[model samples]
Target chain A: MTASMQSSVGNPADEKLGMNLTLRIWRQKDPSVKGKMVTYKVTDISPDMSFLEMLDVLNEQLIMQGDDPVAFDHDCREGICGMCGLMINGQAHGPQQTTTCQLHMRSFKDGDSIDIEPWRASPFPVIKDLAVDRRAFDRIIQAGGYISVPTGTAPEAHATPVPKADADAAFDAATCIGCGACVAACPNASSMLFTAAKVTHLGLLPQGQPERDDRVVNMVAQQDREGFGGCTNIGECSAACPKGISMETISRLNHDLLGALRAGARPKS
Target chain B: MKKAVMAVSGIVMVLYLIAHMIGNLKVYTGRDSFNHYSEWIRTIGAPALPEQTALTIIRVVLLAAVVAHFWAAVSLWRQARRARPERYVTKKAVAQSYASRTMRWGGVIVLLFIVYHILDLTMGVVNPEGHDASPYDRLVASFSNPFITAFYVISLLLLGMHLRHGIWSATQTLGQSNRRRERTVNAFAIVFSTILIAGFLIVPFSVLFGLVD
Candidate 1:
């Protein structure tokens, strides 16, 4: 078994010790309340602990001390569910290309001080400390993010002969977990990278061809209506993406959009 | 759709800049050549299209392009502002360029410069000499003044910066960018804008410093 796959708890024979660190965390009572950075120190933190686990320790401490715990979003601590996201040290997903949940405490030294904050886009209003509403992404997806497959027996696995290149590209585009780190990292708060990832993933497949024209058109319209900034292609979104969704997907999105328009898919006026 | 409008209109303006810069270079060839070239633009299509018809058509198209460009720019700016209604309390710029950051203000400066430029050169009303002079004489007279020459230089520099970011952005908007070609695209933006700016600047600087009289 890999070292990481081994259980993280109760390995006392290992000489690895705990670290003491300072955290500057954003705190707010709720969406209506103003938020600010509140500092708290955590001691005796195991290097084996994931970043969220360390946060869990801090929350435990806060509860024992009769103080409000710093609020953050997380579901699966393994990083696949895309629920947990944080801007650690001014970087989306904390000093790594992976999600916040996968980041290990060992990445930091004992004396390190980390600054944590919530995603700061207008569409994503703060719900509480370190948790902003990401339903804008959901709205974008609902607009045209899926293909229509009839309810029936499953088609033969090889019935559709997709080119290997296109299948690979589609899979690459599908890795996007809808975490909103791209929006958080963008200087303009643009969601082009996320929208494009969704657009390209389905658009590349034969199953997605019937809705191609309408999908790009409707998805982009929803994107604009959500108050996401126009993409100027500074490319910070792709850079901050934990899944490494490429900027080329945005280019593909543009190509598809233009094709749709030229093909008489009138965007909602 | 807004981005596509910005990209297409921006390309039209870039094409106009290229043609204008080449026309400005004709002044270095002497008075007859410069004046003849200016006259030639008006006489284009001649009897087939009537007097100044070609020039009129060009002017109308250019004006339309400029309007569309400005409208798209303002619309995009509004959307960007609304996207982040509340600014980050602590922000760090990661992948943006200086030129990209300064685009809005640079555009304002360029707009102001265009107004002064038309008044000074196209209309001759703000020329240092009287408005009745020949086109060549007006060109010389305008550049002869140190203050006028300095303003021209400063505006052109800002124009170059605007073009540096604008061209790269337009390319991305038009779907011409990819990972493999990104560096090439950036280099082309820098080199192309530099050459265009230098081409335009050569005229006034040459006249001011007596390289052309």
Candidate 2:
């Protein structure tokens, strides 16, 4: 219902019941062209409307006026898809500890000048206004983030006999949605959390034991190769993650990486 | 791989600092006691080892640690710098602690200070009494001057800040820290760095106040 809230369109500020707000949004025509914060006034925004819904209202206004609509990515507006994001007022997913799609407009007061920018990182290049190319993340995942399990019938769930603690921990790490919010929030734009999540998600599993050494080494190499910054363990990535991925996953990655390097592991690629 | 190098080398240096701070507290025992302590460092494992063999080993290890630490830090710094060529137009603080943000530049400052420290204290090139003086006398001579003492204090403060973040970060890098133990690890870093730095700082302050002199 957050995305479905009605805005009193075209109504004067005093006549409308909903809140009026100013948006300072990053508007870039393309990756080659420079971007700037283009301010727009949105009126009669419903308190129940999600942050994206508010933007939706603005984009509607722009389209009606023959102006190019603001571009932002979204799929499941329920926050789990990790498709929608923005640096709403300098925060990765706005002020709330949730995805931009899930963040309700109620968090802001009337007359607020919200600044929306795309994820800022060298690797995640801004594709357009409020949307960045997150393929750097895809490359990182491709770099040994998977186990070499042969294509066959699905194995029995109980066959693995995973320890309860390990299963719980692995599940925690598996929640990382590969959203670049971690990179955007990171001071160095490091993808440690995202990489670590992938590393540890399978790292703690019994099936992950075979390629453990190679996985850590190759993935880390690819991460560096993609021009992502090194991790300083600032804990910003985990803090900004929508899935609430714990920093412990990063520790596990570090531990695995050290052991792999000590054992002289190299990339299978 | 680079983070591991930094963590390992940083841990080595921290271990040495703890021992150095403990030995530094011997200054309160008078000049002979402090001088004997300095000589005692060399005489460790005496019967089986050649003169200064132990000290030489420690120096070699410490030197290796410093070099490795510097190499890792610089490489990581370069990577970080290159990672974000296009800076955020809306500049905002992302790091949790001021100490965390200062690790890179502060480490460089600490390294530069180390060179000055070695020249002044160990080599006695910048020491008022010169290298021939007893270790205690050299120590007293450096702290006796307001400018020298001031430099030492400033350097130690900066080193403390570096150590504060470095300790916690090393744990994170080494996978020794976790969510449940996060607060404990944080407090341990703050407590240990403060105590160790204070132990080192006490001697210079005492000397400057004429207590150790």
Candidate 3:
């Protein structure tokens, strides 16, 4: 394991440390309530504690006092589920890839104050304190994803053998966890990263070929309908992506979208 | 449809710039040709049409295009600001092309220049001394000022930046997606946008440096 992966609870050096930390956390009863940044003082936090674990301790303290624990979302704390997200200081996921759940306290200095809050965007409505409904991304995907394989019977896995290059590319594109970090990091709040990923993932594969034209057209249309901004190709979204998704995908998506449109215009068989 | 809206509006704007530059080439054709060409523009939409109605329509449509372009830009800017509410001290916007990086403030500056341009030339308002100069005289005198020429030059550079991205984006918007067509469209956008910057730049320099005057 690398140094990055070794700084867990079992690490000896991390067990010996504790520190006082300031947390300016966002508190809201629900999506309806107007939210504000509320600061809390936390002490004796283990340096090895994942950022989410530190939050767990803070919540435990709040619960002991019969106060409502600050509400945030997390699951599969190993970073695959894409549930936990936060703006720490000013960087998304508190300054790293993966998620807030995977962020270690060692990334920060002792006696440092941390600002934690939910992702802020009109499309992602806050569910409670730190969780926002990222359904806008989902709606964009629903416009067209998935091969048009019908309802009942399942095809044998190897029956539709895909090209090795296509399969690898699709798997890479499929790594996107719908985290909405790309939207958060973008300068234009453009969903190009998420939309382009979906467009490219399926667009490149033969299984997805039947509905390729409709997929690009419909998904792109849905992306626009959702009030997401057009991409300017500045590429900040790719940098912030935990999955390291590429802006080159946007170029590919654009190319495919045009191909679909042209194919549609030709005289049908 | 925001992407399509931007793409379509951007395409129209690009076409307008190319046509406008072509029209301006009448200056090189001597006074009669220049004046005749201006008259021809009026004649095309003549009778029952007020003088310069076509030009007026084009200007209004271009105005609408500009408004749409900027409105789309502002909406996106606000969204980006909200999405990442945290400001990083490491604000060095490295790795982005300089043109793409400075788009926000550069766009604002260009917008301001556009407003000043209309008042200075079109409406004959705020002409340095506040005296309304004829469009021809306004063209001459305004470009004559070193300060005005410098401002125009700077704004043109910004316009160039806007076009660098806008051209490629507009083609993508219009559904030109093949690598062959994409490359061609992108090259066309670059060359077309560059010519506009060059064409507009030349008029001012020619006037200021006595090449045209």
Candidate lDDT (C-alpha), each: 0.88, 0.87, 0.75
- Among these predictions, the greatest lDDT belongs to 1
Q: In candidate 3, what fraction of native interface contacts survive?
A: 0.25
lDDT at residue A95 of model 1 (Cα atoms): 76
Q: Write the per-residue lDDT of candidate 2 for residues B50-90, one digit (tens) a residue.
A: 88998999999999999999999989888888888876666
Candidate 1 segments exceeding 4 Å error: A1-20, A44-48, A106-112, A151-154, A267-269, B47-50
Give the better candidate number (1 or 3) by DockQ: 1
- CA displacement after TM-score superposition, residue A244 of candidate 3 (Å): 1.4
Question: Taking the tens digit of each residue's C-alpha lDDT, what string does model 3 give over B12-104?
Answer: 887887887778766776656665776687667578777888887888999899888888777767756654454333232323566677778
Best by TM-score: 2
Which ten residues in a row are the worst by lDDT in model 2 chain A?
Answer: A1-10
Docking class of 3: incorrect
Better of 2 and 3 by lDDT: 2
| Tens digits of per-residue lDDT for model 1, A1-269 | 76743544446534356688999999989988788889999988888899999999999999999998888999987778889998888888877789999999889888789899999889888999998899999999998999988879989979999999999999999999999998998877899999999999999999999999999999999988888898887778887898999888998899898889999996665
Candidate 2 or 1, higher TM-score: 2
Q: Where in model 2 is the C-alpha error above 4 Å?
A: A1-17, A150-153, B42-51, B130-132
Interface RMSD for each predicted structure: 1.5, 1.6, 4.6
TM per candidate comes to: 0.90, 0.91, 0.73
lDDT of 1 by residue, B125-156 (tens): 99977678788999999999999999999999
Summarize candidate 2's per-residue lDDT along A117-170 as a digit string, tens digits: 898878888888888888888887788889998989999998879999989998
